[model samples]
Target: MSLLGDDSTESVAETVQETREVVQEEAPPKTGSTSFKLARLLFGGVLAFMAVDNFRNLEETVGYAESKGAPMAETTVPAITGSLLFGGLGIALWKLPRLAAGAVATFFVGITPVMHDFWTIDDEEQKQQQMIHFLKNLALLGGALAFLRVGEDD
Candidate 1:
């Protein structure tokens, strides 16, 4: 069966294979630029460092998340930390970078609202702190998105 609707003669498998070949043929030459590599390492290294901190303070992290009304905090804390660590490593090593960028983006998006609900906080100081964190996360999200578009020339 063809996925392109009626009147399509090509099967899905054939179409996919052809698309893959075209992509491979059109892929840009690897630049291996030192500055770009350094930037990736810096971005990914920060994530990995954060993951390490989370791992070291798993219980405290979970408690904080629970206080923020995160459901299943105990399980979620570790899962999130693991994602950060692995994603950071992948991006740093320039291995499957796009996928790693997605993972990093997902982590920030998932954590921001849950952990920094400034509107819900009544204390002025705490609210300000949360708002700052929220804004920082938004900036980080932008960086991750830019990373996702790193090699679109292909």
Candidate 2:
């Protein structure tokens, strides 16, 4: 009766069962320790704050993009997308710690250089400001990774 062949029905059932088992195996523990809870809260809070701050300054960010010769519309879209992605990852951190941390780390690596290109600036003060922002993001990325590592053992 199956379109594929006589073997298709059994293969489909096996795949479904395997998926269910994988899902069950990956489910988070019912009770998390205090340290794990604190880590999640801190990591999520930082991400949420950064997302909001970036979104609030979208106009300035777009202007910076324009200075770099990027189209305003294209630059604005990524800014908005990053804001939403960060905010969502912040929420996900509490529920899926490891995945959230990895996502945030990847995002930080992608955006840091673009956001703070100190090499492109000649003024010392502006260079320092860019370096500071770059370092801050690195610190946050480290924190997220640490939190995820600790959460994994819980």
Candidate 3:
């Protein structure tokens, strides 16, 4: 007449209770405020937008590279690749943030030298601009990493 067998019922109940306790125990503590969440969302949104913008300007980017003395084929190819890559990365940050942040930080570190190379610029003003761009990217990378850490707490 008893369902789940008399012995199995007690064991099943115990298992259910244990599972609930474990779930509660492992649940993440609420550490982030509403403002922190909003800031994170804004940071992520801006990065996503920039990615789309970069993709939209692929052709103009190629032209800029050509003007900078890059080979025609090489310039165009990298522009397209970078556009697609950054756009994909932006989407990733929006969807799977931890992975995206890690990838972006790694990418920024890897490209920092080429991005900030003072020797590549002939004009003083251009060199200053490049430095500014380099610092901005570094800041963005830092912000992304910080966002990832904050997200993990949420």
Q: Which candidate tops TM-score?
A: 1
**After superposition, which runs of candidate 3 have C-alpha atoms over 4 Å from their true positions?**
1-32, 63-94, 151-154
The lDDT of each candidate is: 0.85, 0.68, 0.62
Best by lDDT: 1
Worst 10 residues of 2 by lDDT: 83-92
Residue pairs in collision within model 3: none
TM-scores, one per candidate: 0.77, 0.61, 0.57
Q: 1-154, model 1: which lDDT tens digit per residue?
A: 5466655554666898999999888746343888878888998898889899999988899999999889899998899889889888877887877888888899999999999999999999999999999999898788788777773431
**Superposition TM-score, candidate 3 onto the true structure:** 0.57
The segments of candidate 1 whose C-alpha lies over 4 angstroms from its true place after superposition are 1-31, 151-154
TM-score of candidate 2 against the unseen true structure: 0.61
For model 1, the local distance difference test gives 0.85
Which candidate would rank higher by lDDT, 1 or 3? Answer: 1
Q: What's the best-to-worst order under lDDT?
A: 1, 2, 3
Per-residue accuracy of model 2 over 1-154 as CA lDDT, tens digit each: 8798879988998999999999888956543667656656666776766676666776776677667655464665466447536634653456565566666777677667777788898999999999998899889777766755755755
